[model samples]
Target: MDNTLSRREFLRRAGMLAASGAAAPMAFNLSLMSEAAAATAPSDYKALVCVFFSGGNDHQNTMVPYDLKNYQAYATIRQSIATPRDKLLPLPGLLADGRQMALAPQLAGLASLFGQGRLAVVANMGPLVQPTTKAQYLSRSVALPPKLFSHNDQQSFWMSSMAEGASSGWGGRIGDLFLAGNSNAALSCISVGGIGLYLSGKQASSFTVGVTGNPQLLWGSTNLFSPSYINELKVLMSTNKTNYLENEYVKVTQRGLNTSVQLDAALKAAPALSTSFPAGNSLADSLKMVAKLISTRAQLGNNRQVFMVQLGGFDMHDSLLAKHPPQLKMVNDALMAFDSAMIELGLQDQVTTFTGSEFGRTLSSNGDGSDHGWGSHHFVMGGAVAGGKIYGRVPEPIIGGADDVGQGRYIPDLSVEQLAWPLAKWFGVPDSDRYLVLPTLARFDADALQIMR
Candidate 1:
């Protein structure tokens, strides 16, 4: 084999390196300038947290019906996975059509947050290319999202407005717009959930942190092996190269080292939070680290920030009744702890946390479990949220119902563009400039989705 590499081979190797280094807190890209127009920082600071549930969650079981009629309908359809009527914690008030909603017993903490006006449920939200209904969906007249019900594509579509393999996402695009506003632009977008497209922007790239604290490794904190041996390794990483692929690697490694040191020092000096996160819970672990990072916002000079945290194992195609409840408990407990941490920091009003899944699972059970679905219920929590209310219309829980495309998979009443509008507005994006961050914003009137205060 020849020693020299071809251009395509080099690019493929570079991609492989990126995949392996996703968890590192590094500046991965160096392209100067971007399409996200710079804007002045808002007087007050704000942050957005996206908690992605890796596999599609079973939302039908997550938010159950409370009314006698609807509960019977849900219980009958859900069969094995149905949350008991008496065991459900009812959310106050009813949907637009007088249908009442309740939470799974494991989600009582979130329900309490809802009662305190710090949380609101966004019902039946999913990716849509346009404002589509059952008629348009059935008639196949509207442009629909490509690769529907696909885990990977929907995850990408949920983060980025486009389908899988899109270069940028709304969060990263939002990060792009405010790069100049932050005292240290590199710290604007953080990810505790490793590398993801959600944090990749036109010019801005994310600085990934860990679920514990800033990572301290031999390369990051100490000289490896012999002094000269580690010194040579550092030299190799720091040296600039003529090839684009080689040069990008040099930049990513060097930036990772530099940022790690800075972040570690800042976190060490930051005060500890009084709130206690549940032990051994992965979601709580991630959110606890997010809280710690937020505690250093003033010192890091991060005025506008977006974070991505994630948990896996929600696919639930089998053993759903047994496996799902524990995960839901984790979600409820972690969020409760995070809310407390924010309150302790007096940043609850400033930070907004939301949950996301690739998609929802079907209402019709496949013997012991549910299948993949389209529309799902999600939670948004913060002091600014219009809590104690359900934002979108919760579809009835009947198989072959009006909203169902098939197998009790209801068509979403609101598009993801409509959902993200209020969040972008609350985070300081100008109304006229939203099209840059959200491509399909023009198709929907986001005015009605007043999710924030």
Candidate 2:
């Protein structure tokens, strides 16, 4: 019999066991675990919600250059796809150079949030091991992220620092640190976007739930044919087995049953939200579920939590002008509703929600639409955010200019680590442990963008 366990298998089993309310027996523990125990306790209630736009979003259209000179350049390059200056919703602040930016007309809700100082834009963010300039990129002097411009690879890179097939993500790693602090650590990281690498930690994994439905036990858990059948199933699950694979499967099944019951009860007991989310908006539905979970935090005994929700159809390879508006509107309305819901729960100051994507679309259009590009504009919203401003270096939109590598694919000035650091620090991760959460963070300046107050 092969008794040796692979590293992957070991971590998976350890994570499962941790989620199943057993943490003491793990044979290996990373230094992060030790530091996590000593980390400061979070505030009364705090949560981070990550809204991911699947497929690359055309951020250039989302955050349009409304100033005359910049708009002319953008319009000239974009041609038919450029959002008309009159249709753009102007933002409150100006760029350092006194150029004005505007949100897409569909993003009126987000523009309102900006006006209220509850939202701040983070310009040109992407996955990077370290700062790289266009010169370095053109000269091939620095190591770039693996598999640039590919959808699957970039998505994985954005979520988990590693390219596709990475096991642990930064979010999951963050959860690993604070899981011990929660009464039910399994609930510390929840996903309405399905099981993603973002929520798979070495010692923790996300508890996935349907956005609009209650969690249910497996079919056998309830008596269908006869009561004896249910009893038999229970006995079989509880019985100690000789085969390792069978034993592990049974353990996982049992833990899942236990978790489902707890979550179902807690969700049922949660108070109904007063804020009205737009009906038929999938993103809003996901955020609605997150709000319910947050509302029931005390019931679930969680002080710190991370959530991920998804919105698709951002690819926009063709018919971008025809299709992108509704997508933008859906996201804007959903975000606005979520902010209001947080206020209703009186957690506006405690919860921060941010946007992420695989990558951004190109600046110059490909006749009808744009191709995949790097470094997109994203926004952070919450009462705690240092709002009404833009963080990071906003690049010039000129195609083949200093920022663009080619065809208007801008090099990211800000790494993904920088975007995630402040949220981790605000959630109680100590400065000493930042490197543990973000492996490549030390490569960049330790100064985090002051988005969170």
Candidate 3:
């Protein structure tokens, strides 16, 4: 076997040879491939992991207020399903005003990080047209996300940054501009919890990794064939490149195989960690796999990358009191584990993790559950995060007031563009490239938001 015949090199040559026919003479040029790889490689080394809550995560429940009046307001609106204020785990840290708030009791795992200044809350963040106020919302003078109450519409709006029916997601848009800087052809934007519209890049689509920290192979048992079978299949894939679809399939499969080989090799070289993630938890397991991948970042030679994972069952349409705590617990625990793992790998500064959801549920309860509403709060956690405080103006718990869009559908105080722009800039996207990654971002001159460094 020729030392130079890497699986990728062979596939590349074989594809070319098949395209031009064996009789037609063409050199097996490796320099062309090298040049192409060099053209796409980036110099920076940063990664972003986005954990999207499929349904609306209840912000009030996640980040609780222990202030007497606010707690009374919350309990009054919640009626039968309100979490007891006494049961809420009080955070020890003093805010700027020396007032104390409690973390959701379930989020006990993350309290320490908050104390360590590695966790922060971005308040009242959602898709926005501009710095529209509650007056603008009630007057209908500004454009708002369409069908804001509908789950499908809101979800799409959240991911795509369009009113409701946008085709592509902002994450995908970021990948589109950033993929030109990636040396690896193994999908710069990947989703571990499965395919999502959010991770779909314009030119580079998302590749999926399984929960067990492996790239899934679609060609099951056939991929396990002996050496002779492998030779036969390779010949078939090479010689019979008549059908365009088949050839494309062959190309993708070969690429996937090569990628898997490299990833597996990298994973094996990663040092094992002593930290233990709780068993049977989806968020914990998914993040454990991410930690494994991040540990291999040096070998993958990727400077910038994006990952999407999700946790579902956040709709909380019923049994809000009984069901919502565990979800928050899972989120808190998983993030704590992930943050610890990043520290273990000395990647605490290099990686930033954040959360987003469809929207926040209403402040007034529907007896047992909550309904979908407009503006919601989100979380950002990393060594780089400026923790211990809220960023956006906190919404008044007053129902049917200026902020509330009837029944507590609060108009957003801060736009998602404002919330995400700083991170995009921090990711090493040049000033000229910001608008390309975030179209809505151009609306706001982010000359003031200090989300990074």
Candidate that would win on TM-score: 1
TM-score of each: 0.91, 0.89, 0.84
Candidate 1 residue lDDT tens string, 387-437 = 888888888887887899999988888887787889988999988779878
Clashes of 3: 0
By TM-score rank, best first, the candidates go: 1, 2, 3
Q: Is candidate 1 or candidate 3 better by lDDT?
A: 1
TM-score of 1: 0.91
Model number with the top lDDT: 1
- List candidate 1 stretches off by more than 4 Å: 1-27, 31-37, 216-253
Report the poorest 10 consecutive residues by lDDT, candidate 1: 27-36
Q: Model 3, which residues run further than 4 Å from truth? A: 1-44, 91-100, 163-167, 215-235, 243-249, 445-448
Q: In candidate 2, what are the lDDT values of residues 324-412, reduced to their tens digit?
A: 99999899889989999999999999999999998998999999999999999999999999899888878877988999988899899
Give one digit per residue, the lDDT tens place, for model 3 in 118-151: 8777877876667677777668898877776777
Clashing pairs for model 2 are none
Answer with 2 or 3, whichever has the higher lDDT: 2
